[model samples]
Target: MTDEEVTEQVREDAEEQAEDAEAETETEDHLGPTSTKLVAEVATQDANLATELEGHLAQLEADREEARERADELESKLKRKQADFQNYKKRAKKRQEQMKDRATEDLVENLLDVRDNLVRAVEDDHENVESLKEGVEMTLKELDRVFEGENVEAIDPDPGTETDPQRHEVMMQVESDQPEGTVADVYQPGYEMGEKVLRAAQVTVSDGE
Candidate 1:
């Protein structure tokens, strides 16, 4: 071959060798180094995701714990309130009972003076039966004043009035000019406070005329 032809063939062979080296370098970057880098990047992302999930789980646990504490606090408050209400009811009931007892004691204390007056009237000496009766009447008047102050009244049903089972007790049945089931006579007067009869009037009931 001539010298110029040999030189041209050398130039072409050098270009082909350079292209093959570039292709080998590109293949190594794409299949070997780039694939390893991609796998490393994926591993890093997975680790970060796992860490984030752990953080979320911890936060959820904290929230649940806070909710539990709140529930316990409310329950405790409810129990305390219930206990307070029960105590208040008990105190009120005790106070009511005390008031009732005090009222009864006061009434009895007021009646003691009447008893004393009656005793004095009975024990004192008198000039005649009329004087003795007048002393007893005075004692009865004082007793009536006390009863009036205490809202107590005498149940002294008049003769010929209708007999009431709630306020009168029949002592005996007797024939009278009045209608049947009427009061013939009041043997003993009754005592009452408000609408409650302390003692029913003892009376003789009339039979049919």
Candidate 2:
């Protein structure tokens, strides 16, 4: 071959190779922007999802904290109520004891005057047995007055009256001119206050003889 022909062929081949390289570069450039855009969108979606998840987690934490606070408030209220009830019970018991003591003190104070009169009667000298008996009767009348003021009644059943098991205690069965199962005589008078029997009447029952 000739030297000129060889040089021309080499130039043609170099030009075709440069044209192929340019086409490939153009194709890469066209695809590059779309691929980069898709990657960027995916990254943006992941970031939004992470932010939403963080928000949900924060709300859940807030709700849990509120519930804990409510429970603590309820527990505190229960403790306060229990303490109040215990204190009320103690106060009620103390008041009851004080009332009982006051009642006893008042009763003793009233009985003191009656005791003084009895002592004076015993210490005084009487001219005769009748005078002594009169003094004793007066003292007994005073005692009866005191008993009446206190609402204490005597449970002395009359002869031939019906025997009361609630207020009368049968001391002995006696042959008497009265109905059977009836009170013959009251041996000892009983005392009662209000609805309560302080002492039952000791009595004898008739045998209908």
Candidate 3:
């Protein structure tokens, strides 16, 4: 209402405003640098974490690719080995068949000469019976020679010798002076080549007298 009173009121209000402004300025000065520093530190940490995550992802992708490549390589090697083994088996079988055929051919070729000599002996005319017998004996000798060259042996077991079931066939047991379970006499001669018996010799085993 009075001019002095109004001026005093205005001065008091001005002093309170000045004090509030000073307090606000001090608060801003204290918090500004601290807030800005915190924001910068948080941004730096986020950038570092993002970079580490990217590196981990890249490494995982690389490892996965490497494992896939290794598996593929192993599969390829296995397939190749299987193919090679199959080829080897086929080749070995073919070689065995060829060897067997060649051996048979060689045997047939050797036998042809023996057959020709026998045919000639049969066809030739002889004046005397002795001459015919001689010719036949000569042919038999030639056949024996062929057998010797081919490594074919006669299985004519001697009397009183042991009877072998593998090379000898017992026709009948006959009473003889020879020991029992022994060969009495060879009825028919057999043939053998190397360790293999082509035909078993037919013989009569001795029965104890």
How many Å off is the CA of 68 in candidate 3? 3.6
TM-score of each: 0.61, 0.63, 0.67
Which lDDT tens digits does candidate 3 get at residues 10-70? 9999999999999999999999999999999999999999999999999999999999999
- Candidate 2 collision pairs: none
* Cα lDDT tens digits for candidate 1, 1-209: 99999999999999999999999999987899778999999999999999999999999999999999999999999999999999999999999999999988988898898898889888998889998899889888878887898899999998789988999999999988878899999899998999999999999989977
lDDT of 1: 0.92
The lDDT of model 2 is: 0.93
Best by TM-score: 3
Expressed as tens digits, the lDDT of each residue in 1-209 for candidate 2 is 79999999999999999999999999999999999999999999999999999999999999999999999999999999999999999999999999999978877777787788788788998889898888888888878887887799999989999998999999999999989999999999999999999999999999998
Candidate 1 lowest-lDDT run of ten: 138-147
RMSD of 2: 8.1
Pairs of residues clashing in candidate 3: none
Per-candidate total of colliding backbone pairs? 0, 0, 0
> Each candidate's lDDT (Cα)?
0.92, 0.93, 0.93
